[model samples]
Target: MDTKSLIIDTATKLFQQKGYIGVGLNEILKECNISKGSLYHHFPKGKEELLIACLQNLKQAITIDIEKIFEQYPTTQDAAIAMIEKIIKNLETEGTLTGYTFSSIVSEMALLSDAVRNACGELYQEIESIYFNKLTADGFSEESAYSIALMMTASIEGGIMLCLTQKTSEPLKTISKALPNLLNSNIHLVNA
Candidate 1:
């Protein structure tokens, strides 16, 4: 990969392992084997700029993955369950959820930086939008789809936190099972 991409990738991994505040630019420079000048050349605003790039990169990558799942599955309920199952599988194999560490960043640095906060918010909205599109396509009203997408996003993020803290996949597994029921109940409510 190119130097800029290398820096972003290394920084993203480090940021995932450690929160935004926990990581320093020097560490990212060392990790990327690039000098301070090179980093600044690529990121004139330094760490915050690099972080925004990382969030944008993650948003694109995750958007593609979610879209693929939604395309492969016939229904939003099936897609939702598959998404949770994929997380469970990743946690089982890797011992942590990768590419989905915005929670840590939000908690660590969001209050301190408007740029970071906005980037994270945009990424979250993108995720929720993907789910909302699928739900609406599957026949949910816009209101119901929006609510379900919000619930799904919150639940998945909360499930990841619980899984990480508890050091087990039980929370996500439980979420996988609960999501279908949640969808079904919502459908019933909408029909009624």
Candidate 2:
């Protein structure tokens, strides 16, 4: 990778693992082995700029994969199931290379940067919207669909965290067998 991309990639990992405040420009510079001149040549706003770049890149990168996840399944429940699979596959494939998600970013830096907070919220809303639409398309009442959408999103996020922390995709594996349970008509309760 070139110097500019190198800085972004390095910072993305550091920021994900440690948080914006946890990682500093000096550490990034030392790790990249690049002068401040080089760093500023690429990012005039310095670390904040690099972080924004990382978040922007993050927005662009995750959207495509998520859309693909939805496309792989023929129905809403199936799509949710496939999404869980994709999450597991992603964690396994990257092997910690991708590090964390926008969910983690908001947890870390939401109150720190307005820009990061907005990006993280938008990223999550995008995923939720897709699931919401898919659930509606699958014959669910709109209100019930929306609730299920949120529930599944939260469930998947929790599943991912559990797996990431435990260093085992067993949560995904454990949940995989129960996916068919979602297809039942009365399985989900919604206040309507």
Candidate 3:
């Protein structure tokens, strides 16, 4: 990797694992096996710059991949199931608590960094939009679709945090089983 990319990637991993404040430039340099000059060359603004880069990288990756996930599935039900299943599989293989990096970054840095917060907020909006589009296409009314999508997105994220905190995947697994019902409720709301 190039110097800048390497530093950015290194900082991302560190921040994900250690939180934004928990990591410093020297630690990132040591982990990347680079000198301070090299680190400064890539991120002249220092830790703040690296943190911004990391947030941007993650948000971009999420926006593309999640939209693809929503597009590939034929129905909202399928997409929700797939989303939950994918996370379960990730948990099984990557360790249950290992992949909450983005959430960790949100918890630690969202309040302190406006840029990071805005970028991450955009990703959250994208996620909600994906769900809303899928639900609306699947027979939900506009308002109901948006509400369901927003609720489900929040619930899924909360499920992940609960699963991580409890050191078990059951929270997510149980929630996955009810995703179809949660989705169906929105359609019913439209009917009523």
| Top model number, lDDT | 1
Model 2's alpha-carbon lDDT is 0.75
Query: What is the lDDT, from 0 to 100, of the residue 185 in candidate 3?
Result: 70
Measured on C-alpha atoms, candidate 3 has an lDDT of 0.80
Q: How high is the CA lDDT of each candidate model? A: 0.90, 0.75, 0.80
Q: After superposition, how far is residue 185 of candidate 2 from its true place, in Å?
A: 4.1
- Model 1 RMSD in angstroms: 0.9
TM-score attained by model 1: 0.97
lDDT of 2 by residue, 139-174 (tens): 777877777777766777677777777988888767
User: Whose TM-score is greatest here?
Assistant: 1
Worst 10 residues of 2 by lDDT: 183-192
Per-model TM-score versus the true fold: 0.97, 0.79, 0.90
Winner on lDDT between 2 and 3 is: 3
- How many steric overlaps are in each model, in order? 0, 0, 0
lDDT string for model 1 (1-79, tens) is 9999999889888888888888998899888889999999999988999999999999898888988999999899999
TM-score order of candidates, best first?
Answer: 1, 3, 2
Candidate 3 TM-score, C-alpha based: 0.90
Q: State the displacement of the C-alpha of residue 2, model 3, in Å, after optimal TM-score superposition.
A: 1.8
